[model samples]
Target chain A: MTQDETMISVRNIGKRFGSVVAVEDACFDIRRGEFFSLLGASGSGKTTVLRIMAGFEAATSGAIFIDGRQMDAVPPHQRPVNMVFQNYAIFPHLNVADNIGFGLRKLKLDPVERRRRIDEMLELIKLPGFGDRLADQLSGGQRQRVALARALVLQPKVLLLDEPLGALDKQLREQMQVELRALQRSIGVTFVLVTHDQEEALTLSDRIAVMADGRVLQVDTPAGLYERPCSRQVAGFVGNMNFLPARVVSQDGGSARIDVPGLQTTCSISAERLARFGSDISLAIRPERMTLHRERPADQANSVSGVLHDRMYLGERTQFQVALDDRGTTIAVSSSTTVAERLGSIDPGAQVWLSWSEEALIPLGND
Target chain B: MTVTSELNAPAGADKTAFAGLRRLFFQNESLRGLVLLTPTLVILSITVIVPFLLMGAMSLWTQIGFDYTDDWSFRNYGIILTEPLYTTLLLRSLGMSMAATLVTVMLAYPMAYFLAFHVQKNKLIWLIIITLPFWTSYLLRVFAWRVVLGYEGVINTGLMEIGLISEPLSFLLYSKSAVIITLAHAWAAFALLPIYVSLEKIDKSVLEASADLGEGPVMRFLRVILPLSMPGVIAGTFLMFIPTVGDYVTAALVGGPDSRMIGNLIELQFGTVDNWPMGAALAITMIISITMVGLLFMVLSRLLKRWVAA
Candidate 1:
């Protein structure tokens, strides 16, 4: 992206809390008006990165810039960024209107304009006439909306959200996710969200930075990260993937032939992933991509015979755990319940065949 | 149908009777709570309420020589309102108590803040140390203050020995400032604990949120910390002020003739003056005035909160 497209640039930022290294040499650029997510598990330092960007924390090394202005000397309040805290931190003593209008005080707006802005924010958050209600009077979802309104009312260049929807119930969380994405799109504000929920990140983020142990493992679009994870760790973290030990037979140009001992077949990997990580690699396949059949299909190049060890009936899809002839390896295959019904009564102990296309077998870096 | 209705009537009556009794004493939470508090109510009525009512009754009667007359009159209250001695002493006591409360709260606030925010370990030890002075007798503490402030006492002796002063100062010991200082020291723990509890109850995130919203440290404290800690401040004020207003021992020991407060006058009427009715009237007046001042402070603090929030 060009300099104008880059809204916030975090450059080689590192933070150490006494003996613990919270964030180590993290570098990334958030594009303007993009919904970006730092996705990680707990202790992955995603929140720390968001805090540093917001100027709540000063990096022990390197620097952060917002709109090409160095933020090292700026305090959080003075920075051109606002944050929606995880707990929503609505001032309990103030009514909803005052909470939303808090940042407006620093702007020194006239009463008419301030009221107009606050009312506009309340309406945007779907909370008209809620200005008179106190913080304690608000429910969890209401508080979340109020927090969003409070931060967005300032119209900062960038808005940071630290697990903004982590506190809601599953249903409310899903609904808010859709609403939040729509809100971000309509306002065209760069939203940098920190979350451990992969589904939430995948659904809401335009681009995701996968973090682990205070290091950025990969930065890609959600589909790119899920479909073509650069490392085995990212693949495992992003979604369920069955790994089978594979040996590279040959490599030419961008394609490589790999032998999967568990599947008992040599499949062509249409990518040069084995060259960088060497011959000892794992063939990763999503469960849904593998098809299960009772009879061996004649045209299939990659197929393995196994016995169904377990069957899980998930409402839309049924997952079957298959034990191959190889002693201790089990691979899961998921099929639509409609297809399972047409296949006619496959018991747990029944024999099954699993097959997939060559493009489904992704050669992942072992490291 | 008529036979079935008649058969159900006795069972329904029995159920209603049991439910009524249960609702009165057990089913309703407030009524159950009142039932559980019966013992405390009885004890308080006997020990406090009965004596207070008797005192109020006595305040309207006249005391003649050794025996008290049964004639009920407002003569004691009239004397209290008309006599300059009673009014002056009451006003002096009010002023001294207010001064003591101000000094105590101001000094205790920093200590409470330190204990709440800064101290990470040995908090219980610090709390115990603060209350250690209370373990000593109250009279002993007053006397210790006397020793510290008296002529040729700790302050005078130390200053003179160091060649800072030519002679011992006589004004330090027998003065209103001495009484105020002693009362403030005695009530420090009372003021500190309530303020500390309030400050400790403040969610740390609220302060961080304030700072994040563009408020500096001073503004954050004024907007968040002070308002949130108001309950403890009010509690501490009442804790220090009400008791100090009626304190007789400290005034008697540290205060000279001019610094004597209404408590000393009440003590004189009850003891040396042999005027029980007048003493009762003075006590009643002190209680009423203290209660009124407490209510006024509460209202003022609430208004201050609203103003600051706005």
Candidate 2:
């Protein structure tokens, strides 16, 4: 997005609490109406960055611009952003309508107008006839929806969510994820979500910024992040990536031939993903990208023979751990249940050949 | 010979009896709970319930010239209702206690807030420090207040030394304000405990949520923090007001004849006037008034909760 279209411009933001650095110099542009997520594990400083943007925290160094205004001096109340806290933070003393209408008091709308807007929000959150219910009466999922409505009612320039679905169970979390996505689409408001769940970030965000050790490792589209991570850290964090020690054989204009010592095979990959290192590199591939075969295939250019170390059935897919002959290390290979059924004696102790296209191997230099 | 025969009937019978007794006591949950509570229940009845029942019965009798006659009448109550002396003292007691409650709770709330929000480590130490003065005897504390608020006491003497006053302020002691002030200081710890607990129980995120929702500090306090802490405020108010209403020691120590409350009058009736029924009646009247005020407060608090929520 262009600079003019950027809703939040975080310019080299750094935060420190006394001696410990919580977030390094992080910089990113969140586009207007974009669902952007800061994905990381615990202590990755994603929430700290979100808090800084919301003005609940002041960055020790650097500046933040929201809708083209410097937010360094602006307090949380004056900022054009609202947050749904992790615990929902619904006022136990206030009922549903009061909680949603909390921020709207600044507008000083007439009673009827305020009531209409509150009811509209209740309807949006699918809580009809729940305006009078106190917060204590609502269930966890209901509380979450109310918290969303409370923030969304203000129609702020941006909505910041700090692990909003972290407290939910597996089934409810998935349901809320879908509902949250649909709600964002309907509102067309820019959303900045901070979560430790990589799957959640990938599923809900238009752009995901993977963070590690208080640093923004990479920011990319979900598919791009999954398919072509810039570093081994980002690739490994986003999904199950198997790494094999490799060396660059040669480099052409558009592709690079890499030699994998562990697999004892040489494969050519797109030069665009070639890491900036000497010859030593690490070849990373997703388990689902590599296929298992009954015998060595003559047509396949890249193939490695290995013994099946373990077999795991995961409903629709089956995972196979293969121990390569050249290197005793095991690599996980996944296939659809149908493909696994076609392979004879799909059990441990069976000999299998693992094969994949050259594009499946992402060259991440020894991280 | 018959008794010997019964005793020797069956040794198994005694075993069966013991087994049944054990099962009856252990298997029945409610019964077991009652048995466990029996000691406490008996002690409470003897120390509290029996005295309360006797006081209620005595309040109905009349004292006829040093002899308490069980004529079963509300003559003592009728006298208290009709006498201007009794009525004024009761009203003054209620008014002073109300002022004391308000002052104590108001003063305690900020200290409690400080403890809850500002002090991070050694919270128990801070709490103990807040209540350190209360560890002293209540009467001793009242005497200490007497030393502070007396005509030639700490406040007046200190002011005089600073050349802020020409003479010791006579109004500082032997007045209704003096008693109120003493009561407030003595009961401050009670107010602080509840207020601190409720304030500490408040989720920090809720305050953040309020700020995020576009409320500055002042408005946030008025709308969110203050309302959420009302339970504690109400509890503190009750704890101070209810007991202080019948407080005679503070008045006796620092108050003049003009500041004598219903408690002082009740004390006089029981001790000097030698009228037990009259004292009992006066005590009952104070309780009834206090109960009415308590109920009124409950209703008002309910309305306040609803109003804030709505």
Top model number, TM-score: 2
For model 2, fnat equals 0.93
Tens-digit lDDT track of model 2 for A1-31: 7777999999999999999999999999999
**Residue-wise lDDT of candidate 1 within B1-310, one digit each (tens)?**
9999999999999999999898777668988888889999999999999999999999998999898987999999999999999999999999999999999999999999999999999999999999999999999999999999999799999999999999999999999999999999999999999999999998886776777778887778888888889999999999999999999999999999889999999999999999999999999999999999999999999999877865
lDDT of 2 by residue, B1-310 (tens): 9989888878778889999999999899999999999999999999999998899999999888967789899888889999999999999999999999988988999999999999989999988888998789989998888799888899999999999998999998899899989998899998989999999999999999999999999888877888888899889889989999999989998998789988998999889988898899999999999999999998998787667534
DockQ of 1: 0.49
Superposed by TM-score, candidate 2 places the C-alpha of residue B256 at a distance from the truth, in angstroms, of 1.2
Question: How accurate locally, in lDDT, is each candidate?
Answer: 0.91, 0.91
List the lowest-lDDT window of 10 residues for candidate 2 chain A: A269-278
Which 10-residue window in model 2 chain B sums to the lowest lDDT? B301-310
Q: CAPRI verdict on model 1? A: medium
Q: What CA root-mean-square deviation does each model show from the true structure? A: 5.1, 2.8
Q: Is the docking of candidate 2 incorrect, acceptable, medium or high quality?
A: medium
Error of 2 at B56 (Å): 1.9
| Reference-based lDDT, residue B99, model 1 | 100
